[model samples]
Target: MPHVPERRPESLGQAAYRQLQEAIETGALKPGDRVSVNALADQLAISRTPVREAIAWLETDGLIVHQPYLGRVIAELDHQMVNELYALRFVLEPAAVGMAAKNATDAEIDVLREMIAFERSVLDDPIERERHNRRFHNALYRTAHNRYVISTLSALQTPMILLGPATASDPKRLLDAYAEHTELVERIAAHDAEGARAVMMRHLTGGQRARVSYLLNQQRS
Candidate 1:
């Protein structure tokens, strides 16, 4: 299991939830791994009640399933889950990017540029690379300045959070993704809402096809 640091938590339950979520996200808790409340409570240094609460929440998020007699199991990675993820992304991400193109301020655009500019320093660390990518996307969505959009997406378990590690683990795919982000940012900076939306649609469509195809073929294999 990953050593998930405690958050600046108000209650023990929230801290336990965040730590367990991080473990699942980083693949320290795998599909077949045992999820014992007693063991998790000891590991998190929290009481059983909080760990139980955390487990309940994760179960609702569909990350964990209670198997008959087998107890709690991490949900297996499958194409349907990945498709559901991309389906939501197609609906929300491009709309947010379109809004960002219309509404983003000079300062907000600069923030995105700086995020891209700082990428080279983190290229060696896979975890940092993933985080940087998330921050950039989060910043883009926030640039829309819509509270509802911000709140909804913030509450979501991102692609990495929903599934295990990234499907696009290839170095070349990572580079291509960075390029796609850059192009979308430039479109937004130009106040070309339609252009930005088109860029985002193309970006998501390519990823959806690739990931879905991989999973389907993997199942056959």
Candidate 2:
């Protein structure tokens, strides 16, 4: 007989956090929308305690802000915020990729390739594709062998997730992104640190453009 692993049930706080996070990510909870803790708790069919806890956690991640009179609201993204975020990414991700070129083992590279394939297979499903996209970047972060870089990227995930409708949602953009990932992986496999960094810079710059365009379109709509 095969042994089965035990499954741990999610705590109310954890469940609330995930639901709230998804709402933010999909734009169901749009930026600048105020949060009503009791209202959300009632909507989730959970008590206020867990909902409050989730909000607190999100606040720490800079996903939600608490104003004196306005209460809690989703963090708004502007052109300046977008530029700052990408600038930070520019400083961090390229260096991480460069280090990954030197540090990632063949098995780690294989995992990244598998993630890319997974993303391609989910083209018809934006939600799954987005999940896989994050997974791929996270895999690369872990491959870098730097704890501070990994932690910083992890913390950034909250704000990053709030950017809805990925540029890869378009078929052409999806193909371009996949091609870029392929080239990046190739550069890493060859242990070309500088080449990997260059590819990463291009990738991030393109993504920043796409994100800005998406934000502008959202505003116009």
Candidate 3:
């Protein structure tokens, strides 16, 4: 008989980490939801060790909290945390847009234009619109060509997802966001770093206000 290769062991820890992160981002595991290691292990068809490790990872990322008696729970967003997030975004995103304007290739700009077109087409579908919005931001970050900036912005996305409801929910706000995106793309294509930066900063500021307002309304109701 021919010898068979041994099966590679699965990295349950990594898999569990990804699963938990996705759940949190998609609102399935909402803020303050209890984390159950054994239930997660069963759900994921993995071991408790991995589930524990995954919880630790999320905790370190500020996505979840582990209490001595209360167990692990999804991290809830307070007004202060929201403000801090927007402040970080305000500082970093403009710098990223500026870098992108200076460094992005013609091919990259074309990709961004395509993303904008896709976003326009999906305006009626909130889910699809949100996906395109993310794509647009990811493309812009990629254009910056800075690994650190790209990674940091990528990490920031999970928290943004906690804001709930797509930013495209408001037609007027959606139109405004698209217009700003279009302007940013054009400036980048024109290699106007300062213009791109200014437009991006304004865009983020507007978006932050819209998101905060929406969250506040939800709390009120």
Candidate 4:
């Protein structure tokens, strides 16, 4: 699914990892898709060693798993994993937004506003919406100026790809989430730390509930 050109003689291992990881994150490689090390190496025009190295790292990161029959397939989000992800966000993101309220410059706040506008422009495109959703959150957290929180949230990106985004499912859900993002930007711009934190909590809680409902319906189907 990933189309990479010939190796550039740089860090081949890191390049392989990035290409493979990007494919997983972008849905070019979806959940439960069987991964072949040889296929990946050939596809990227790299050798087997780097691709295997990348696969090992992906397994360690929980983006890949070895099942009884499926071999190493892309991991899916189960109930427990969903709960754990939201629990971590509940602890980290709310506070991150609060810190962002206090620390973000007007320029950084403006960047967030621009991302929200861009998100609206691409609401009709699922792929672009998912991409901007990650961009928006990544920008928001960086405004907080806390390296530890940023690092923790960054580590969650791969598994979060499995869960996808709030906007991917329903048009109504996308509008609701857009409004929430607008309000969050306003709160941060006004330097309302507690208000921003409260808004983030609501956003995360809504996303958590939606994801759980989605998983249940998926099972029934």
User: Which candidate number would show the highest lDDT if scored against the true structure?
Assistant: 4
Model 3, 1-221: lDDT tens per residue? 99999988757888899888878766678877889988989988888998999999988888888766878888877666888988888888999999999999999999999988888898887666776787789889999999999999978876766655544578888899999999999999999999999998889888878887777776898
TM per candidate comes to 0.84, 0.91, 0.84, 0.87
The TM-score measured for candidate 3 stands at 0.84
Off by over 4 Å in 3: 1-10, 67-69, 166-168
Sliding window of 10 residues with minimal summed lDDT for model 2: 164-173
Off by over 4 Å in 4: 1-10, 68-70, 164-167
Clashing pairs in 2: none
Q: Candidates' lDDT values, in order?
A: 0.79, 0.85, 0.84, 0.86
Cα lDDT for residue 124, candidate 4 = 88
**Each prediction's number of clashing residue pairs:** 0, 0, 0, 0
Model 2, position 179, has a per-residue lDDT of 81
Candidate 2 vs candidate 3: which has greater lDDT? Answer: 2
Best by TM-score: 2
Better of 2 and 3 by TM-score: 2
Per-residue alpha-carbon lDDT of model 1 for 15-72, expressed as tens digits? 8888988888777887667799999999888899999999998888777788888999
Worst 10 residues of 1 by lDDT: 156-165
